[model samples]
Structures are given as C-alpha cells and as structure tokens.
Target: MSTFGVIARREIRLALRNRGVVITALIFAVWFPVISALGIAAGAGGDAAAVAGAIATIILPVGVFMGYLFCADAFLREKRDGTIETLLCAPVSLRRLWEGKVAGVAVPAYLTTLLSAAVTIAAVSTLSGTPVAAEPLLFLHLAAVVPVWIAAAAGLIGAAQLALGMRENQILGFVFIFGLIFLIAGLQGVVSGISPVTEAVLAAVGLALLALARFIAGKVTKERIVRTIP
Candidate 1:
C-alpha cells in the first residue's frame, strides 16, 4: 500500500477503537435524523419534498459533526504523545499526510451520515404509512456535496489541531462547533426548498473550501507543530 493509504488506514483503525467516540457519534447520527423526520412527517404528511428537505438539511450537519468528532484529536493526540515527530521524519509529504488523515475521518463520517439519511427515510415512511423517498437532487447532495464538505471540515480541523496549542485548540474548537451548528440551523428554512442550482453552488463552494484547506494544511510545518506542542 502507498504511504497515504497506510496512514489513512491507521487512523481509521484508531478511530474505530475509541468506543466512546464511536458510540457518541452514532447516537448523534441516529437521534437528529429521527427527530427531524418525525417533525417533518407530522407536519408535511409524508410529502416527498419535505422529507427530501429534511434529509438535505439534517445530513450535512450530521456528517460535518461526525468529521469533527473523529478528527477532534487525530493530529493533536499524535503531537501530544510525540508520535507525530517520528511520522514527520518519514518519506511522506505533509500534504499527503493531511489528505490521508482527512480521508480517514471523512469515510466513516460520510457513512454515518448515510445511516442518518436512511433512518430519516424509514422514519418518515413508517410514520406516514407510505413509501416516501428523497429526491435525486438530495441524493446527489448526499453522495457528492456532503462528502466534500466533510473532507473540508476534517482537513481544516486537523490543520488547526496540528498548528495550535491545546488551549487555543479547545477555544477554537468550541467556536467552530457552535458556529457550524448555528449556521446550519439558520439555513434550515432556506435549504428546504433547495434547487439544482443551489446544489451545484454548494458543491462548488465545498470544493473551493476543500482546496483552500489543502493549501493551508500544506503550509503547516513540522517546526510550527513542534513549537505548539504543550
């Protein structure tokens, strides 16, 4: 396997072994979708548009939150324990390392978000006594835009964790989490009627942010990270 794949697989293995984090992530992933679906079903009477909108609105935040959960300690833990130094001496470039870590966190996060979506659809159908499904655009949103956003989030958060002190990371982590929560909450009404144009625009924005995060991650140096270690 390539270095990137090896690193990514390692991180995935570590993430899965953290039973506390995994269980917490699973609860959030399942709870939000179920609650949102129940509310939408009660109000919209199993309307496909409403169900789709609820799926679109809830899944993005759930996926991003999962990324945050998995990546919260990915870089920081390594740096704190002095493992990052050894890894840094390896032949792999910093950008590839960042990509690998981001991919590692993003894969499971995206899958959990898919589970959230499925629960949403199932809940809506069960409650409404009809087979309701998401629109294709929403599926496109899930398949394409959601993963990109998760990757961007993981990359940015991992960069922050690597570059900042523990205190700064804690403060900034709270800000990032709350900021994202509020932003998604504010967008709930707007995304409910989301169109193809909106999905395209979101995909473009996610890609741009992912690119920007990659550039930022590439700029993070070993010296800077070592200095930030507590």
Candidate 2:
C-alpha cells in the first residue's frame, strides 16, 4: 500500500475506535431526516420544488457541520495523542500525509451526510404525500456535489487546526471561515450587478488563500497563522 493509504487506514481505525464519535454520528444520521420530515409536513403547501430546496438547505448545512466535527477531532486528536510526531517522522511527504489525513476523516463524514440526506429525502416523500421522482442525473449531481462541499469544508477546518495550534486561533479560524461563508452567501443575494468574471476571480482568490494556508501549515506547525489580506 502507498504511504497515504497506510496513514489513512490508521487514522480511520483510530476514529472507528472512538465510541462517542460513532454514537454521535449515528444520532445525527437518524435525527436529521426526522426533522426534515417534520419540516416538510408542517410547511408543504404543494410546492415540491420549494420543499426540495428547503430540504437541501437544511441537510447540506448539517452535513457541513458534521464534517467540521469529524475533522476538528481528526486534526487535533492525533497530535494530542503523540501519534502525529511519529507519523511525521515516517518516510512520507507532508503533502501525502495531509492528503491521507484529509481523506480518512472526510470519507466517513461525507458518507454519513449522504446517508442522512437519503433518509431525509425519503421522509419528505413519505410525509409530504408527494410522489417524488428523483431523477438519476440529479442524484448523481448531488452525490458529486455533496462530497466536494464536505471535502472543501473539511480542508478548511483541517488547514485551520494544523496552522493554528492555539485554542484561540482555532476559534478565530472558525469565525473567519464561517464569516467568509456568510459573506459569500450574502454577496450572492446582492450580486445582480456583479459580473460572472468577477465571481470567478473571487473564487479563485479564495482557493488560493486555502492553498497558502496549507503551505504555511506544512512549513510551520508551531505558531498560529492567519491571513490578513484575503
């Protein structure tokens, strides 16, 4: 097996051994759908599309939140347990090490989200009494999009925890990340005059910032690093 695969196995194994994490994830997997069903029943005024959109909004955020929890633990617990130093001393590139940790943590979180989403969709169909036909292509789209979003969120959180060793830094990192999310969401609501080119430019800039965060974390794991200029 490749170095990344080995590290990924170890990380996943450690995560699986944690009963609290498993139980919490299971609870989320079950409750999210039930809540969605209740929401659908309470507010289904015959608009299937609106119901679907609302369901997506609620479920996607929950997924992202779960991804954050999965990663928050993964990033910090390994180092806390003294395994990270051993892992880092191994014959593996920093990039591959980071990649493995990301994959190991992200896979389960994404899977949990997918399962929760499926359950929620089914519940919506049942409670709304609407014959919901899920287009295969739409399902495929969701399957692709959900993971990417989760991975992106996980990457942000992992990079934050890695770069910022202090608890205050982690809190600030989360504040900034969520602040950026809301900022972008707000911009989307008010960007009638913004050109597509500008939007693309902004996205590219954001991605570059993430890349820089990764780079800095790999270089200096001791001090907290935060970007002042976007």
TM-scores of the candidates are 0.93, 0.76
Stretches off by above 4 angstroms in model 2 are 136-138, 173-230
How much lDDT does each candidate structure score?
A: 0.80, 0.63
- Which candidate achieves the best lDDT against the true structure? 1
Q: Could you say which candidate leads in TM-score?
A: 1
Cα lDDT tens digits for candidate 1, 81-145: 88888988999888999999999888888888888888887887788765556368778888898
Compared with the true structure, what per-residue lDDT tens digits does model 2 show for residues 121-171?
Answer: 788787876644443322542455445556566666776666656565458
* Clashing pairs in model 2, backbone N/Cα/C closer than 3 A: none
Candidate 1 residues lying further than 4 Å off, grouped into runs, are 184-192
C-alpha positional error of residue 92 in candidate 1 after TM-score superposition, expressed in Å: 1.5
Q: In candidate 1, what residue range of length 10 has the lowest lDDT sum?
A: 183-192
